[model samples]
Target: MSDQRSVTRSDLVAYCDAMLESSAFQDYCPNGLQVEGRNQVRRLITGVTASQALVDAAIEQGADMLLVHHGYFWKGEAAPLTGIKKKRLKALLENDISLLAYHLPLDVHAEVGNNVQLARLLGWQIRGGLEPANPRSVGLHGELETAQSGAEVAASLERALGRMPLHIAGNDRPIKRIAWCTGAAQGYIEKAIALGMDAFVTGEISEPTVHSARENRIHFFAAGHHATERYGVQALGERLAAHFGIEHRFVDIDNPV
Candidate 1:
């Protein structure tokens, strides 16, 4: 057991660092405490990815800290803080709210990962990674307990994610083996195809993905990225609430994409 009352900023960082294993991933930005704030924290808010809308919502709700899957200062982005990035940071700094981000680590956690949670929701038994070469590969391959048509699986996905998935069935195949990677991983279609998956699911779609799906003869489903990513943040928030006895809220900004 651990004490949960009156924790300091350092304590919170240490807690998140341990939970997310921040040191392991080659993250684009600093994983923990990108922007410092008050020494003590009592309330925690979590969102899928750090966006302007999410930051605004956290500030409006008077959150002491905000945790996200995506944070500021990503690699390949302009180093200068002069545009939208500047405004976001300025708002966070002025409000004195701490920003913490965890990317790949959040996607791979057994209990709280996006793929794991999706599988739990859809009753899929996970087998292994879609990419055999990469252990940290976020895409997962699994099978339904029973057989289902491509349309039926799409309906299940829509119900679980609260958005009707964009379905592209290639070969009228009955789906049993499935591969999924949440959040704009349409590019992984080839990986899923190589794994001989009957269906592949991801958060967003690309123009080339349509062609890939047709050419490779694998069912491709584009569920909303924001919708798919909601679970991990909620799980992480619940974990924090249980661990630290703090007020935890998951603010959902409904994104249609």
Candidate 2:
């Protein structure tokens, strides 16, 4: 049960940065406290992305702050805040809703992270990071307790994620060992290949990724990006709310990608 208490915005952000170790990551975007609003956060809303729909939902829910896995101000995007970005920021600013976002930090966290949560969801026993050389690797390698056919794994992913994964059968081997990174980490397929993983699962796939998996003879599953990542922010939000004794609600804005 939640504690049903309130916490100040500063304390909440500070605690999250400490718990998630946001400072440690050289993230593409800012990790914590993206947009500041109310001083005290009584009701917290969490979501996959800080999209306009999420902002509206947070406002409707009377959220003091909106916490999400994906936030604005990415590395290569246009810096100027105009068009949809401007509108979204305007809504949050007008409603006095704080925005907190976590990226790589949330994905690699020990607990309540996207990768860990996905493992739990799929009942995969984690072995270690996909890239053992990198201590802070975002993707993880693991095993399915029992080796199963590629189709079986695809079915499991579809059942859990509510989206049919695009399965690319690279080898004729029954899959036991696998690696997965949630949300647009197709580039890490090479890491999975290097680790000799039987299969690789991730959100979003590129044309090159298909060729890589086929040539490398490793099964690849392209699960929906939004679907694979829905859990981390919710888990983090619930824990944060419980720790601070505050009300927390997760608003999922449906996105096919």
Candidate 3:
């Protein structure tokens, strides 16, 4: 730790807000300090994505602050806070719970980002972002330290994450080059296919993604978004806990992918 005074929850939020440049992007939902609760937070709760279940658990646990990788207010979602959205917000507000959300920022954070963490866990070395134009591209492409067969890679994913990946083998080729984007990034399968990757991995899958994988001759793996995303938030939360000497618990609400 630095010689400076220990940072508070607000200080952490401020640091994250500044680092993410939250205000620069037109976000669907409010970023940083969504629901205000205790002025000083001592215990932190983290989860893969902020679903209603997560909110309820945090409230039940009496968490001082809640951190999540996915949160409310996504692009193209209805702006009106009327139905489920209203209910979710009301739950937080009623409990006076503080909500901290990090999305793309956390995904591309180099060290603690979801992609980086996944790569490390799977023994892949990231080369660069899939999209070169955007510096903060959420999708990452990389290669394994040593090539493994498709089935072998599947075993690695299953063993590491406890979720058997839905592997769509495009070829009998040994797996070497792989592209990954955690959390509902099936849209990028074609991009991975274009990159000549032996396989593409993501947290979730869509109907068309399967066909695309077959047609493009790129292996596809749906590794469960919740499973893939659990790493980054937990890493970040642990860091914050150590930095502030606060209790941190990563709450997992399993979602079958």
Q: What are the C-alpha RMSDs, in order, of all predicted structures?
A: 2.5, 1.8, 3.2
Query: What is the TM-score of each predicted model, taking all chains together?
Result: 0.93, 0.97, 0.90
Which portions of model 3 miss their true places by more than 4 Å?
A: 1-7, 24-28
Root-mean-square deviation of candidate 2 = 1.8
Clashes of each: 0, 1, 1
lDDT of 1: 0.86
Best TM-score among the predictions, by candidate number? 2
CA lDDT, every prediction? 0.86, 0.94, 0.84
Residue-wise C-alpha lDDT for candidate 2, range 71-123, written one tens digit per residue: 99999999898999999999999999999999999999989999999999999
Order of candidate numbers by TM-score, starting with the best? 2, 1, 3
Candidate 2: lDDT of 152? 97
**Residue 30 error for model 2, in Å?**
0.9
Best by lDDT: 2
Q: Which residue pairs come into collision in candidate 3?
A: 203-225
On TM-score, who's better, 1 or 2? 2
Q: Lowest-lDDT window of 10 residues in candidate 1? A: 1-10
- For model 1, the superposed segments whose C-alpha errors exceed 4 Å read 1-4
TM-score attained by model 3: 0.90
lDDT of each residue in 124-204, candidate 1, tens digit only: 999998778877778899999998999999999988888899998887879999999988889989999988899999999
